[model samples]
Target: MFKFGNIYIIAAVAVIGGALFGFDISSMSAIISTQAYLCQFNQGGLDSDGKCVGPTPDVQGGVVAAMPGGSWLGALVSGFASDRFGRKTSIQIGAVIWVIGSVIVCASVNIPMLAVGRIINGFSVGICSAQVPVYITEIAPPTKRGRLVGFQQWAITWGILIMFFICYGCSYIDGTAAFRVPWGVQAVPAILLFCGLCVLPESPRWLAKKDRWEEAREVLALVHSHGNADSAWVRREMEEIREMVEFERQNADVTYFELFKPKMINRTMIGVFTQIWSQLTGMNVMMYYITYVFTMAGLASDDGTGVLLPSGIQFVINVVMTVPALLWMDRWGRRPTLLIGAFFMCLWLCVNAGLFATYGKPATGNHNAAVSMSITGAPAKAVIASTYLFVASFAPTWGPVSWAYPPELYPLRVRGKAVALATSSNWAFNFALAYFVPPAFANIQWRTYVIFAVFCAAMFIHVFFMFPETANKPLEEVEQIFDDTKPGAIKYIGTPAWKTRNTRAAVLKQERDQLASDEKIDAAAHKESVNA
Candidate 1:
């Protein structure tokens, strides 16, 4: 009944979905090295000397990879859920699933049970991750769209930071409780998100497609005009949405096959690859496996404090750096932001690779085989700083842009499904990398950074050649940029049309003014007819 009308409040509330993802990230990252976790889950348990060597590299990788594997399936289904149930309802469903998954995760007694619980939790994340951006983008005004959708990424960082510290604090508690407490605590945010969704409005575009025209107009007015349905801005937006929805209705028997058609394939490719590239940036390596990286850099200690504190600092940097991107995303535009981010990320990864290769040596210390090589002193410090810089590069750029971009590339008829497909690509790659990185560390050592650096380089080239500018354009206009038939369209680069700021607002204002002129002419004609 008390729906949030302010765009910022809506964004803040909806992005709790993203925070669920954040909670999962740190829940394991914070506790995997602890004695309780090692004893409870690792196959070998403690070594002959009673050192807390956790699971073998492959086993650990499987445990970490489980969530994303489940997420891949959940993402594939989210499109149907959102399209049929509505975005608000779909996110609510995800919240409920997260609570169930968290409970299972908290109650697990062994590795198989743990993996199963994480898989369930990952399913919820897949749904939330795919739909939160779509809901935010639909409600936000064009000029502020990027900033608002960017909130999802910001929420994710906060979730990571808050949960990491919670786990850090709990680490001091005696066995079992250290990890169980944080895993169980993850359910709290899901509860909040479920309750929050009760008061959130469904996407106005979704309302329009359902032929609930008056409801759509009211929602638009509520979001953009303080409940004034007669406002010109609201009217123009509703008109654009109605026209687009009407046109799409002609071919609205939407299927995944539709996305591969010539008119839509470019966006589908861009959307899917954009998500893939985001994971390949290796930011998640720093988030999920940073402790491992730090250990390899000779930062591990018996109590785990050495790596935990620095990992905490990286999460802080991630949260702080995202703020500016949310503020300036529209001004900077998507293509330039991604290109610049990829370039800097590549640079940082290269520095990390060179440092590790140059100064690292085979480990003989009390470390897991996963950390086969160790670097100390100056080179190790450089490795840590390089990781920080890599995160800084990704936080404001690929992190937010990747989530916001895909949902904006589709029509109302297929947005939920298209974004689901794209997000599944993200999860697929996420599963592979999460599973691969631990073993990679064991086998290749310094070459892990080299692989990611190469990915960042390829991503820079891809963004430059394939991604067109989408910033400040209405969702309806984005498809035209990919349409070769459109007289002045551009896909590989920006067109002259998108050069100006607030382009959507400007276009809407012109249309509003023209509507007034036409209405006045028709009124005058009707008056002359009555007189005659």
Candidate 2:
């Protein structure tokens, strides 16, 4: 068996790019409330209470939305990069892009420059988002794949957590230094990721797909079998991979258009909608506009500490909750985990909406006064508690599952393109939500939770009906689940793959034993006949 440590190391290094993704998410939100950031970029000056009156709703939306727009372009192009240059190389390229973007953002003097920098960073994040999971899935052993791939999500949360605290610390600084310090810190992860990738092995599956069998075998031996090139387990796994690759090469002309075929369309939609639903869950709303939520909840609207405290709590909850998810995701299956998470998310959203509706007052056109009085005491505390619960529910479910599911659905032929499309769908919807939230809060106030609550309800239905159980299945076997004409296909799709895999493994062992017995008997007979 592979050394588990090596597997984690590889996965960890590859997923550092996810840190950059998380950093960007929190970095903007963190600084938006700072007087320096607002005075530099926004039109209106500081209010009577000294809170910086910032960009208009439309401008704010565009600035916040720009990264996802860039991410969309980055994700679309990443498919080609992954297919052409290889997954490792694509990730390295993304790291370089991220550093470039980080510099621009750190040095930005105007809103346009900041937007450009965010777009660049967004592009880089898109590349990482699409390729990292695919690379992890291809390299990880079947039993450990879910948790291994889930590392990206874990890194993402860690990134958010670190950036949140960094921004909090930076809040003490006056002038442009407040924002610049946090913005500049992003380069560290990007650099480390690039260096890490330089020393790592290329994905064995990608090597094998290109007919580089010897190289692929070497990688699999080193990575999966602890340098035992002749180990039966490694041989068996390599053989299966080779056969699958050869079969696809001979039978199918793989292309982007192949994803649209009847056999593949359902799987494609499953990938796309998984991401769409993830963005609609209002997780980013919390990640991006949490200060606003806290403000409305009766926390100090003007103090950075008010935003920092709840976000720090969120970061802790996100990290803690994900551990159980990684532990249980393979056991519980993707659909059930996602379904349960969505149900709770809906419930929490409804509770949040109700709390806000009951206790929250309408904005009086004075930003500071409106938030300062709208919430307080027991009702305010309940709103904060519900927000945490919502995050807790999502951390274990949609947060990681969205990243894990898409790569598992498509065959090798179109896997890169399919994931790219799915990731783009994520960014597209993310753009809509990120752009919409500021205005949404501006216009609808507490009612915004109601919209997300409805979306959560819809997502629950979608997962129950459309998503099949993929946990513990080999990538090849997962492909078979889509074949309608295959006998017992319905049962295969509906049931957890782990159970079926166990049964199949047992049957195969019995067959092997029986064949060995027959061979021994035949050898004994031959010896007797020769002696006679």
Candidate 3:
């Protein structure tokens, strides 16, 4: 078998797809404020400055959020590919799309054109968001699976951070053409990812389930030279995957309607609702508009930074937070982190928004600011600090753990479909938030916070009730729980929210496992030393 030591390098390579997702996500937010990006596309006619002139609130919202909206459509692509083509191929396809989309976006002439390009990029993001975890989970040694799969989230955050820096630097250029540089930089990574895919082995589990024994054997040999170690594991895994696929195939054709079937019904619910919760936690809303908040706070021009350094800092913070999944996720699992994260996110959101709400519209500028002139704080500082807290809350827990859970919980055959549904749901909700936020800010600016807080509270309750601890649990173990009709299956039905599997016992067990593993390694090293 391949040494466990090599898993990280494999994970880092596979998870570049996540980086593409993250890069596309925050990149467009930076471009929205640039006058050149918004130039001359008028619903009715152009204004004196050659910008579209109208009080088209909804239109502005759509334009502002098109990238996220597009992602929803793109996210569905993974389900189809993962189920049919395999996770690796789906990711490779996404890389191709990312490069094309980046070029189109960099060369865009108008807002609508830019939106088209963003939609393309969003498609790739949606696919990667679903595929990366599945790929990682399949390749990672089960002992470290949760943490390794978690690396995808960390990669995303890192991408966001890097893109933010690119955006921040490019924004200083003061023209639309200058903005192109940051957008263009994305192509480099996409191209590299595409090149990398040429040599990547398809997930052996995927190969085995497809009845491609030869391919699976070849792939396994590469991963592990110790006499077809991967092949042995694949045989065990394939039995289960084959059973699930046969069950799925015999039940009914794959349909949009099938997601609601009884066996899949619960998984579907978790996937979709959790995704909605992930977005509604108000993380994206903050990322989307915090720059405007900063400008209103007085960090940038009165016209607003559109996006700012404070926002960049948020990206950096998110990136930093995102990395922890690589180290802690295998230990902490999913539910506890999400529950705690939801509360913290909501708490900070309330605090930040409440502080801003205290200033009211006058200082922040209502659409009809002339009618209601109110004094507000130099929102820049408040905006910056609040967004940092918001993003920080996002990256480590809700952001990473959310994606982590679905892939781990679902069966190998169903994983892609499940993740696809969930990811698309996430993208859809993201679109809604992005599309709605500006107008909502225009309509009942402060009330939006109230809505988000409600969602956050709902998220906390939902996770505590429905979501269980997946930390250190094998994929088989998770499915076994779901498959079990025994008392342990019913055991947790009445269990108190906080007293679930992700307990101190679980945590201590994880620690002991780590220590024992280290001792084994040391012993192996000494034995090798003696042999040498």
Judging by lDDT against the true structure, name the best candidate: 1
lDDT of 3 by residue, 1-532 (tens): 3223256677777888888867766676665544444443434355443443332556656765777676788778787878688878888888899898889988877767777888888888888777888887776655577777777778777777788778777766765655788889998887877777666778877786677867766665566443343333444445555566566556544655666655556667776887889889877767655655655555554323544666776777787777776577666767778888988888877876776677655543223211122324565356457667777777888887777777776766567777788888888988888888777766676667778988898889888777766666656556655432443243234354355575445546765786576556657867888999
> Whole-model lDDT, candidate 1?
0.86
Query: For residue 344, what is the lDDT in candidate 2?
Result: 99
Q: Which ten residues in a row have the lowest lDDT in candidate 3?
A: 364-373
Could you tell me the TM-score of candidate 2? Answer: 0.90
Separately for all candidates shown, the number of backbone clashes (residues 3 or more apart, or on different chains) is 0, 0, 5
lDDT of each: 0.86, 0.82, 0.69
Clashing pairs in 3: 297-378, 297-379, 297-380, 333-471, 362-374
Q: Which sections of candidate 1 miss by over 4 Å?
A: 484-532
Residue-wise lDDT of candidate 1 within 1-532, one digit each (tens)?
Answer: 7788888889999999999988988887888877778878767656656777778889898999999999999998999999888899999999999999999999999889999999999999999999999899888877788899899999999999999999999988998899999999999999999998898788999888888899889888788778978665677788899889889988758999988877788889989999999999988867998888888787777776568888999999999999989998877788888989999999998998898788988888555777788889989999899899888999999999998888888878889899999999999999999999989989998889889989999988887766777777878887667665553342433454234234545656765786687567657867888999
Using TM-score as the measure, which candidate wins? Answer: 1
Which 10 consecutive residues of model 2 have the lowest summed lDDT?
Answer: 497-506
Off by over 4 Å in 2: 1-5, 251-253, 301-303, 368-373, 484-532
TM-score quality measure for candidate 1: 0.93
Residue 429 in candidate 2, Cα distance off native in Å: 0.7
